[model samples]
Target: MEKVIEMKGITKVFPGTIANEDVDFDLLKGETHVLLGENGAGKTTLMNILYGLYQPEKGEVYVNGQLAKITNPNDAIKLGIGMVHQHFMLVNNFTVAENIVLGREPKKGLKIDINKAIKDVEEISKKYGFSIDPKAVIENISVGQQQKVEILKALYRGAQILILDEPTAVLTPQEIDELAVIIENLKKEGKSVILITHKLKEVMKMSNRVTIIRRGKVTGIVKTSETNIDQLAELMVGRKVNLVVDKEQAKLGKEILRVENLVAKDSRGLNVVDGVDITVNAGEIVGIAGVDGNGQSEFIEAITGLRKPESGKVVLSGKDIYGKSTREIIDSGLGHIPEDRHKRGLILKYSLFENGILGLQHKKPFSKGIVMDYKAIRKHCKKLIEEFDVRTPSDEVNASALSGGNQQKFIAAREISKDPELLIASQPTRGVDVGAIEYIHKRLVQERDNGKAVLLVSLELDEIMALSDRIAVMYDGKVVDILDRKDATEQKLGILMAGGSLSEAKREVKDVE
Candidate 1:
């Protein structure tokens, strides 16, 4: 096989971190090559050097067996290399065709040929079996469709080599399956792909060859057929990793949270969450399973007091806490791990110690009579760092300085340590590595065992099946059905997620209550 990309002796460094050190990576033609690593392990840094977003301090890049100097993204595109970032960079207000043909568009004399651009985009999408409306606005489409637009944008740019970073991070399971097929189609067209992700299951399902990197150096490169999940996990983390989540059966207790006839509107002033009811008991985990944008966010926000419910009784330990101030709700025994960590969970610019006591800043030990207590705050932050295994050099460092997993761990430690009666963890392990996922899962289960109510909301059905004592399926802003752990399967969940009737979904599960 011909080598499409060869990065030799790559070394990239930041002010306080050695991102990549003497990393050698290569991708063969017409193959899906995976780059596996822990968060901040220099996987993205290495790929940025290849994509010309960042220049390595020392390295040599070869494209199609020839030396290449790619100092900018334009240079990379000219070399038939296109990258789809983890966060889609499309302008939300622009049409799909317009976004795809932004820099390189067909011209008709003095003006851009809009029709030509749309036709070109439609043709590429059709060729790859992508179901995307070329004229639809980016924000108007579903997240899965938006992802397809990103892929279409890459294909329209005449790319022979594509780099996808964490492509399945925000996608539903069905969308992930579709993306796998799309990658296969791209492979059939003889395009080389380099996938950078920490998901071992995806690596096994998609890659032809797998490269494991740990702390900025390549650990091992092996054929996908020869490596199992255990081997890949060990190689990536530099230790033995237990993949399965170990926990005992739940011992149910009294109800900690109850919601009745909850209603909420989305940003567009539409009723996204309508007539929903849920209950979570002490010593139990109630997981909300649904596709993204199915009113899960609004439901969580209403419960946490981030958004007020239109009409509902949000009873926290027998107290109606609906429409209460966020602080009031928190003081009423609620701990929230919000869906958007950067936006909702942490102040990125603040130090770790500052963010550690964010919601608790007004309370005792952290603040005394409105005077900030730095000594006590620092002590608590240091304890959380050690107890939660947050990998950071010092508590003075900004929260943004840490990796995604570490930031999440910090937030989890902060919320869990407060020992609230009810804990709401939303997408707790999204975009984290397998090791971090394991740690977070154990903590959630621990909270349950300690007689705290845990409300888990996630798009990953497997996660729901593994963690939830009772599973609530949501569709179109309503709780379609609630099932016991034994009655919930991926197939039945998928049917309910797609808005199928409860009876139809229950028919698929033999022992349903």
Candidate 2:
């Protein structure tokens, strides 16, 4: 195999951290090579150096055996290197064609040829089996379609080497499989890919070779054929990692939360959550399983008081709390680990100590007659940092200073510390690494064992299956079926999630246990 890209002794440093230190990485021609690491482990830093978004303080970069100086994205693009960021950088209001052809627009004399741009986008999308509509607005499309547009944008720029940073982080399982096909097609067309992700399963399924990095340095490089998820996880985290979530059977208790005829609307004023009824009992995890945008977010927001329900009874511990304010709801025994950690879980600009007391800022110990007890707040923050293994330099630092996984851990720690009667954890481990996922799962199960009701909402079916005592399948804003853990399989859940009738799903699978 020919080495198409190589970085030797690459070192990058920030004010307070060595982002990458003496990292040597290489990519072979026409191969899917994964750069695997935990959050803030310098995986993105190294890739940024390669993409010309950041320059290495020291080291050499070689493209096709020739020394190259890529000081900007334009330079990298000209050198046949294109990168699709984790967050899709498309203008939401723009059409897919417009986004793809923004920088290099095809023009007929003086004006941009819109039709030609659309045609070009369509051609590339078809060639790569992306199935994207060129004329569709980015905001109106599914997250998966928007991702394909990002890929199309890179491909349209004549890229021979593509870097996808956490591409599957926001995708559904079906979309993930579709992306695998897209990658295979790209490889068949002689294009190389550098995949930056922490997902061990995807790395195993998609990569030809895997390079494991931990704490700013390469730990091991191995052929995918010879490596397993366990080995890769140990390499990434520098310890023996527990892949399976260990938990005993649930000991059900009285209902902690009950939602009857829950109706909620999206920003557009159209009902997204339509008459959904659900309940979570103490000492059990009732996981809501569905594809994203299938009313899960609205349903959670409705119950959490982030959004008011149109018509529903949200009973918390037998008390109807639907119309209560968010703070009142929290005070009335609810802990929410919101779906968007940055937006709802923590204030990015606030110090970790301040963020630690976010939902509980009005409570005792931390609050005394409207004057905050900074001493107590700091004490609590430090405790959470130690307890949750939040890897931060200090409590005085801003929440944004921490890594994604650390930030998530901090939020979970703060929420769990509240010891609320009903805990609503929405997409708790969405973008976190496997190690953090393990910790978060254990914490959720611990809460259950400690006689707390946990309502888990996640798009990852496997996660729901592993963690839930019972699975509630939601489709088109309704609970299609709630099955016991013993009766729930991925296949059955898939059918229910796709709006299959409960009877049809029941007929497809034999009862277990």
Candidate 3:
């Protein structure tokens, strides 16, 4: 196979970190190559060097068999290379066509040619088998659609080599399926692709070859046809990873949290969570399974005191807490692992030790009436960093400096350390690597075994099935059905997630059987 892109001896260094070390990578002309690694494992750094976002201290880039001198994104684009970042770079207020052609606009008599831009977008979208509205505003579109616009933007710039960074991080199962189809179409069009991800399933399903990176170095490269999940995981983490979550049957106890007749509105003042009723008992995990945007976020926010419920009774340890402040709720034994760790969980600018005792700043040993015990705080945070296996150079660094997995580990450590009676973990392992997921899963189960009530809200059905004792399917802001772990299957949950009745889901499962 002909090589479309190659990086030889790529070495990139930051102020205190060697992002990539003597890395060699190559992409075949029409193949989907996966760059597999854990968070902070140098996958993104290598791709950034290739995309001209950063220059390697020691390396040579060969584009289509020729040495390339690419120093900027424009240079890379001119060389027929494009990259779609994990976060979309589209202007939200502009239409899809406008965003796609923002830099290289077609012109007509000293004015931007809007009609031609739309036509060009439509043509490229159709060629790629994508169904996107060229005139639709970016803000009004779904995250999945915004991703499509990013891809269309790259195609519009005549890119033959595409790099997708963590493309499926925020997508639903159906959206992931759609993206798989889109990648297939791109492959059929003979465009080479580089998929950067920590997901083993995606690598197995989408790529022809896989390159594993760990601790800033290449560990192994193998054909996807020959490698199994276990081998790939071991290579990526440098250890044997227990992919399956292990836990014994739950020993149910008294009710820890009860939500009755809950009704909540979104930011636009529309009812998103409507009449949700559920209970989490001590020593059990009650998983909320649903497609994204089904009022799950609102329901969690309402119960956690992040948002007020219009009409509901949120009782924690037999006390009403619906209208209580977040701090009060926390003081009342509610530990929340918010979905967006950066926004709700931690203050990015603060040092790790400061964030470690964030909510507890006003409490016992760490502080005494406005006098914080800095020595004690540092000792406590250092223990947490070690206990949770947070891979950071020092606890004095800003929280923003840590990788996503490390930050999540820190939050998990802090929340679990509080020993709250009721722990509400939302998307706890969303972007974490397999090793971190293993650790987090084990911790959640350990909490459950220790008689803590856990309310888990996740979009990953497999995760829900693996961790929950009782699974509650939410649809259209309602608890459509709740099933025991033994009674649930992916087929049944899939039907219920799409708004089907419990009986209908059962029938579908029966038909499948």
lDDT string, candidate 1, 191-222, tens digits: 99999899888999999998898888999999
Q: Can you tell me which runs of candidate 2 are displaced by over 4 Å? A: 510-513
**Superposition error at 296 for model 3 (Å):** 0.8
TM-score, predicted candidate 3 vs. hidden true structure: 0.96
Give the alpha carbon lDDT tens digit for every residue of 55-125 in model 2: 98999999999999999999999999999987679999999999999989999999999999998987898
List per-prediction Cα lDDT, in the order shown. Answer: 0.91, 0.92, 0.91
Task: Order the numbered candidates by TM-score, best leading.
Answer: 2, 3, 1
Error of 1 at 68 (Å): 1.9
Model 3's alpha-carbon lDDT is 0.91
Q: Which stretches of candidate 3 lie over 4 Å from their true place?
A: 108-111
| Best of the two (1, 2) by TM-score | 2
Q: What does the lDDT read for residue 115 in candidate 1?
A: 98
Clashes of each: 0, 0, 0
Error of 1 at 341 (Å): 1.7
Please state every model's RMSD to the true fold in angstroms.
Answer: 2.2, 1.9, 1.7
TM-score of each: 0.95, 0.96, 0.96
